[model samples]
Target: MTETTPAQLIARSNRLGADPKNTNYAGGNTSAKGTEIDPVTGTPVELLWVKGSGGDLGTLQESGLAVLRLDRMRALVDVYPGLEREDEMVAAFDYCLHGKGGAAPSIDTAMHGLVDAAHVDHLHPDSGIAIATAVDGEALTSRIFGDKVVWVPWRRPGFQLGLDIAQIKAANPQAVGCILGGHGITAWGETSEESEANSLWIIDTAQAYIDEHGVDEPFGAVRPGYEPLPVDARLERAAALAPTIRGIASTDSPMVGHFTDSEEVLEFLASEKAPALAALGTSCPDHFLRTKVKPLILDLPATASVEEQIARLHELHAEYRADYQAYYEAHATAESPAIRGADPLIVLIPGVGMFSYGANKQTARVAGEFYVNAINVMRGAEALSSYQPISDAEKFRIEYWALEEAKLQRMPKPKSHQGRIAFVTGAASGIGKAIATRLAAEGACVIVADLDLEKAAAAAAELGGPDVAVGVAANVADAAAVQQALNDAVLSFGGVDLVVNNAGLSLSKPLLETTEQDWDLQHDVMAKGSFLVSKAAAKVLIEQRLGGDIVYISSKNSVFAGPNNIAYSATKADQAHQVRLLAVELGEHGIRVNGINPDGVVRGSGIFASGWGANRAATYGVKEEDLGQFYANRTILKREVVPENVADAVYVLTGPELSRTTGLHIPVDSGVAAAFLR
Candidate 1:
């Protein structure tokens, strides 16, 4: 057990899991055995340290590795030979832990214990998966690394897989590794360094073998450098389908989809063989567990209208769900529980790249990444011969395995907004962006709605990845546009939990100087825009039957007016009243309506981008640089108001602090006397 301490083992696991090409998030596992004194008996006993269920190897910690008595775990093999149920085996493993319910030892711990080495590494590296899932996996394993590794046929991971692994090790005493067909590879050594190096060496050697002896005839039809049709090029078309797909996939727990149309993704989708290959199955079992066996494919034309696309998507989804039910029926056993859900985790559109779904943006992005990698693995395997993934029965067995189900149950509880979705208008900058950022940080998927699509997308990208936020163009003043945007929010993130109606503009002029154009513009955005966006989002919340929060970014001018600001003040006043009416109407539906009136945020606000601050500073007879100080001095608290100050007020109203209170306006103007709530 030299150099195989828990700390060293964790470090080795992290090194191997760090590279996605090596192993994806929480995809691989490693284990080591060392001797420790039993506290009660005062005797040395072999202790097996394995990665805990649902722990990511890349960020492995001492706590993530569960310590089990090797002798007790190994004894289970003798006690439960030819076990009748997965539950019995899982329970046996749990009993082997030093602490009764400390952390569930990895399902692979049984097999790891039987390995003749002190350390064992099980990885789902793409390079080895390509060979392991190939049609002639046994032949490929024998040909590539002759006598260095043994090849085990496809076996659902459980007590049976562990037994098979032990028998293989007993027979091939000199073999350093075993490649599980249609799964991944495993390596063993007396030292952690050797196990890590041997595992990677096996993968690199297989990849080199593939490179050296090119396939005589590739199986799939893939072309190099096809015409680039980015998803962004058809942003409107893609956005149209987001809400539809999201709604169909939504179960009791909401899920969000991450959209991607990078060049590589586009090239893969554009390939003639993509549809056929994608339908085949996942390249590895780990992936089958994350994403279902295959994605739901749809035919979407770039020019299709939102209505047409929605109708078509609904038709396709019906068929997809039916097929999924058929798949479950075909493979279910008496021991198997009811199928979790028939919803597809991945969706493929002909003209679009790809979209992956999960409970939140982070999980969605992981699905997207796994699917993209699966594409590459499928191509690599096809080139070698045929892309031969595990059979449907095997996939079903692993997907519904009791041990796997327990892993999910044992995971920690989620954050308050873990599966919630939010839409923030004018989120490209200022207070809107801050609110979106805060929601995402709290584990909510966000939609960045703005008039500028490109800028909105850029802001979404900055906030997180495509998974964390989606950007859509919407003129909130236009009822149709507002409705479509709300529909898209539902489609992309399942449903809306919080809506920040923060998109508005200002016009500073005397009542006489404020002409028809200025007056109309202010009222259209501040008054009409708030009404349209709130009503549309309210429809979603009502349909979901889940309570939601709606906050309007009203202005301090609603309570206190400034000279030459009649148009802006009047519109804000309208917004404040609209909140009250909506609150009264939507209260029975469990939707809380609130407002935050902010002032003196001259720096980052979009309303002041057109030299408004300079003009205001001139009126005060001070330099533009001194405007912040002037505003600060005017406030009773003498504090400068920032966009974040406004954003904090929004959180207070939506957060548990005021969960029971609604129809209220919180002022964020650094204690402006006239604007204080009276």
Candidate 2:
């Protein structure tokens, strides 16, 4: 066989990882053993290049591979101190690294290094795990593959497990792989292509076996009352319950949530066997690490009203937390890491579907995907025999493993507004766009709400696509539109914690020239609009019980008594007062209401470009293009106030720096002395 290179290994890994049916996101490891010239010794040396910790194989790169000298790696066996000291071996891997060591070695490094194969693949394919976790897995393996695949008993992943697998491989030369008891599967070959083919063969063969002999209903009959709700009703209920679920899940720390109602999830949730099997928990270490020991299955039936379900959710959440605390106390030893969190990462509702929470959107989404994989494992295992998994004590050991805690510790500090969701009206352009960009950069997911759907979507794309930002058309003057925008926010990002009321237009006209139509138009867009948006958002904030921020973009004219601006000025003044009123009223709920007062923001502003600048310039007797400089000259600081200046104030008001400062109006008018707050 031709020797495999690192590049070929990467290609092979990508192919295997691309299909969800083969393995889950970041759930497996692949390795290639090759020879390299030693820089100092000027001689050939063997090296093991394996996928590193926290990397997804589908997107693996050269930088993601940890290169270790095989000679040094194998030397650890001489000093092996038995099962009790297996964890210390992970730390010792640093000494075996080749050169700068591309990426951090993972717990599975020993498995790759100890096994005598030129190429190796360890994966958690749903089909492979089914046979591995079945009650009669050993007999099933013997009957299905004969001597082609071996079976190894359950063992926690460490150096000792590596030794066991190595011994099994040596004893059975005909075997291409082994079904890791209560875990996953491991396959290897003399070349990358062979190894990949072997892995696929094992997965396919096991799946075929299950297909031929499996029972008709693996998860048992669907409970009559637990059948999936109608499509519209399911979504409506999911939206209503998301904020409350996200709230309880984030009791310890803020989290972004993802909801799914796929066929697999709905089928399992509606099954009579779901509750008992869910309590048994996931078998794969990768599965439980992201999903927690088990999900919080909503006890109420699908036929229950949404209101009743919500009420029962609160009680279930309390009980879940208590049960989690007990689980921690039952298994914690003096050497174990502190309890990470009591909140269940995955929450399952019989008909409403599942909601998963994490520190960010991708993590939350991937956790849900992993739980689906778990559901598949459960389905297949039950079909083959009974779905047996690792014991609670073993699960506790891996969950609180010191090595896992160290990985958590090494993670970089989170950005300022991490896990926050912001809804910005008029975000398609000008100050609103600037605010959205800034907030997203600080780790807040943004909902760009504007009257122009195309522009809002374009700006959302520029900010970072659906993950970080999404666009919704909203005429804030219309209360229904405002409500719909908030609903979109809830659906897109679970809920809104920050709202920027910045949608408005101005008409530079005197008292006689300012018709009644002008007054109504300006007031409706700014004064009434801010109130409508705030009112709609408050319901979600109160429901979440997570506390929130509402910031109004007023103007210097709000207090400075600018000339020929009666309607615009009146609306601005009304908006400024709304900040104070809402701040006082929402204070008990920990919702801070604030405002930013800025002078002419002429550059790149949609309002200014839409003829408002020319009108203001004509009113002030200055060239239209010079209106920005004209306004700047009048400020005490002589600085041109741009949209970014207003955006900066919004960030500060909603950020932790001003967490306690509510009902505050920050003047971003380049130091307009007359507009200064008293």
Most accurate candidate by TM-score = 2
Candidate 1 lDDT, 353-394, residue by residue in tens: 577888777788788888877876776687776788988887
RMSD of each: 6.2, 1.5
lDDT of 2 by residue, 1-678 (tens): 223488998999999999988899998999999998899999899999999999999999999999999999999999889898999999899999999989999999999999999999999999989988899999998988889999999999999989998888889999999999988999999989899999999999999988999999999998988999998888878888888898989898898888899999999999999999999999899999999989999988888987998899999899999999999999999999989889989999998899998898888888999999999999999998999989889999999999999999999999999999999999999999999999999999999999999999999999989888999999999998888788778877888899999999988888999999999999999999999999999989999999999999998889988888899999999999999999999999999999999888999898889888988888889999999999999988899988888888988888888889999888888888887778
Which residue pairs collide, candidate 1?
Answer: 242-491, 243-491
Worst 10 residues of 1 by lDDT: 219-228
The alpha-carbon deviation from the true structure for residue 500 of candidate 1, after best TM-score superposition, in angstroms, is 1.2
After superposing candidate 2, which stretches have Cα over 4 Å from the reference? 1-4
What lDDT would candidate 1 get against the real structure?
0.80
Kindly provide the TM-score of model 2 when superposed on the true structure, using C-alpha atoms: 0.98
Off by over 4 Å in 1: 2-4, 37-43, 99-102, 214-219, 222-236, 251-253, 262-264, 299-310, 333-335, 412-416, 425-442, 447-498, 503-551, 555-565, 576-678
Q: For candidate 2, which ten residues in a row score worst on lDDT?
A: 1-10
Q: What does the lDDT read for residue 194 in candidate 2?
A: 91
Best by lDDT: 2
